[model samples]
Target: MAWKFRRRVKVIPGVHLNFSKSGISTSIGVKGASVTLGSSGAYLNTSIPGLGIYNTVVRPG
Candidate 1:
């Protein structure tokens, strides 16, 4: 089995900082829509708050 570590801290109402074993990332937006930029790449994250449906798109740099 593999273990992973991740932590999210809210910087403000719609902003968050994400920390993980791999690296750090930042997320900005409301519940259903947000953008995450990290060491791997930039991603567009979207989801239905209550339905548990979500999608992620990688943004070309």
Candidate 2:
């Protein structure tokens, strides 16, 4: 079996918030958690307590 190494990239430190008549969004990331809203939908990505990482996405039906 081959072993692979993953590189960690540092995210810009700060909290971001956006508000509009259509929708509302917010994100806070220092070292771990990250979130955003895109054309497809909104998503939150973060590291779980035990699990490696968790990602959730929500879109309109």
Candidate 3:
């Protein structure tokens, strides 16, 4: 087996963006809120009424 030599080139400028799935949490931070998830499922159990995001919990009760 033979390997071919490739030239290294810098990325183009303009149109700044990122593409990666290494560690991107889908759920955003829910500060001052009570949100939880579990093997059963995830739910937004807040008496705040129409709460968007607050916090995340492993075992929600």
Query: How high is each candidate's TM-score?
Result: 0.91, 0.35, 0.23
Q: Per-candidate RMSD vs. true structure?
A: 1.2, 10.0, 15.6
Top lDDT: which candidate number? 1
User: For residues 1-61, could you state the per-residue lDDT of candidate 1 as single tens digits?
Assistant: 9999999999999999999999999999999999999988899999999999999999765
Give per-residue lDDT, candidate 2, residue 7: 35
In candidate 1, list every pair of residues with a backbone clash: none
Could you tally the backbone clashes for each prediction?
0, 0, 2
Model 3, position 45, has a per-residue lDDT of: 38
RMSD of 2: 10.0
Over 1-61, each residue of candidate 3 has an lDDT whose tens digit, in order, gives 9654433222343211222332211222233443333344444434444665444345433
* Order of models, best TM-score first: 1, 2, 3
Candidate 1 residue-wise lDDT at 40 = 88
How big is the positional error of residue 54 in model 2, measured in Å on the Cα after superposition?
A: 3.5
Superposed model 3: Cα runs more than 4 Å off: 1-32, 48-61
